[model samples]
Target: MSHGVKKRKLDKNAQESLYFDSYSDVTIHEEMIADRVRTSTYRAAILRNAEAIRGRVVLDVGAGTGVLSVFCAQAGAGRVYAVEACSIAEQAVKIVKQNQMEDRIEVIRGTVETIDLPESVDVIVSEWMGYALLHESMLGSVLFARDKWLKPGGLILPCRAELYVAPVSDPVVEERLNFWCTVRDQYGVDMSCMSDFAKRCILSGDIAVTPVTVEDVLSHPARIAELDLRSVTAEQLRSVRGEFACECFGSSAVNALCVWFTVTFPCEDNKTLVLSTSPFKPETHWKQAVLYLDEPTDVMQDTKVAGEIHMYPSEDSARHICIHVDYTIGEHKKHSKTFSIPDGYSEAQQ
Candidate 1:
């Protein structure tokens, strides 16, 4: 959906969506979402700030099932613009009516970019994070909405996010790689290295290797990037570049470096009321991003290493990421690189 003032469809598909047509061409995992509904920490701000919402104009993008919209209405919002993109928006309508507050909440069925908003909104609340906060890259659309619709002083929920990096050692990924090599070796003895086919799957299985949690990686994460929700746009977040130097804390076998970051929303106090990722959070859809050393690095305890990594978001529709990493451990130099989805690119990488 394109961002514009007039309420208009971007293409034929968008026009068809206006009818709330079923996706007969594609299969939806309805069974998977049957048991799920929704997050925490925002409850206090959402429930406690009754006055803030009481007479204010609010917008809820991707307001799946319309629960939050109803909450805003319950808080006395004068106009609650609830936007949803799924066919089940009818359920949200039913829920709104069951609560007996349809008068204050308006359910709009379309992408926020396509929906016509009457005027600027005082608040924009959205649950747009996807696995690690950038997976789907829907943040771009949100920014477009922010620039086009939010007035000065408008509030965006979960207002800050940070990216962190660290040196890590893990036995799991190494073991899995050896297992694949062994299996292929045995197959070659029988005049059928065709098992290379089986070995290939392990390489594509991003998680086939054991994952080193955030705790293992961040001895002390040197902050790389900190973004304020008050003003961040899709274009700006597309590429993250940084030069980071860290030390190998112990004699460790480094097959790859694991990188995971987090987003935190602060309360009135400086404390993080809700942290999205980083070392403090449980793994979300965003798995720890990896940069392999290709050939292992046997770092002596207490060696100084300087390195840098560049993360480029995929330009394709999939919104993947391509990562390049280079480093010098003590006197030894090593590197590894890989591209994101729709690709399995790997090189000697210097």
Candidate 2:
């Protein structure tokens, strides 16, 4: 089961920092639960699969407030282990008791990777997705849990996930970028030169979590990558690589590339439930990730924007991410750029 990729280990101080950054407050959990798209999807997925959950042992990774664990218990799970690594686990214990499922649900306050479970479980459930699907680094813990405690044929709540990208026209970003030039004209000063610096500051090589409308999408989205939770390893998540090709709908200025993800829950009778954070779909708390180019590129109908994307954890901080994109538009020369999610913006903003 070795993925053959060396996993980066975080030192004790870095681990503590990450833990505090992620779970220092209740606001983060509130935002997640308030996201109807995310919370409802898991609720429906679990309720729809009641047959699979009934009398089966289940594990909820990073079980914030034990919501998913409670859902499993309501679905008739024989026993539910809610594993949380932060102080929030203590709150989850109270929530489980308040719901009167104390006997069926046990809140374990520890990281799933190192936590001890009495026995293997029949299902693993987790709401571990971050902005752009990989920012928080929680999926790695879920994978570690799967390898250690999942039964041979146990189910994962979100069995499959897909990452997508497309060319987009972001007017807000365009206006912001244009503000630098406008300052020179409005104030009659030679401040236009700062436009380059402004672009750098705005496009700071990080994934911009912003709302993108369907009209903003200038091209058809291309599937950049996918992961099957049932078998994917933590090491395999260290780097994800894929090729994408998107065709412009018509002549338009492509200022940024938009990225989003869709996760699917398997159900009986060959059915599957999908939760999409696509711009065309209802918005989630995740919104969509926008990677701005240094400048806008013009494209005509049928213009092909093709590229390869490589996403991995940043070396300096495992919770942060580094993205390398190499792309070509129509007859244009290939361009490559590297983007990083800075340490401070890693989890706090998400």
- TM-score attained by model 2: 0.93
lDDT of 1 by residue, 232-323 (tens): 76667777676777777777666555666665544444445554445455544344555555456777666666677666665443344555
Inter-residue clash pairs, candidate 1 = 131-286, 132-286, 261-278, 262-277, 262-278
RMSD per prediction, one decimal?
A: 8.2, 5.0
Q: Whole-model lDDT for model 2 versus the true structure?
A: 0.86
How many clashes show up per model?
5, 0
- Segments in model 1 whose C-alpha atoms lie over 4 Å from true places: 1-38, 48-51, 74-76, 180-211, 269-272, 283-287, 334-336, 342-350
TM-score for each predicted model, relative to the true structure:
0.74, 0.93
Error of 1 at 174 (Å): 1.6
Q: lDDT tens string, model 2, 166-220?
A: 9999888878878878876788877778878778788767778889999989987
- Rate residue 173 of model 1 by lDDT: 53
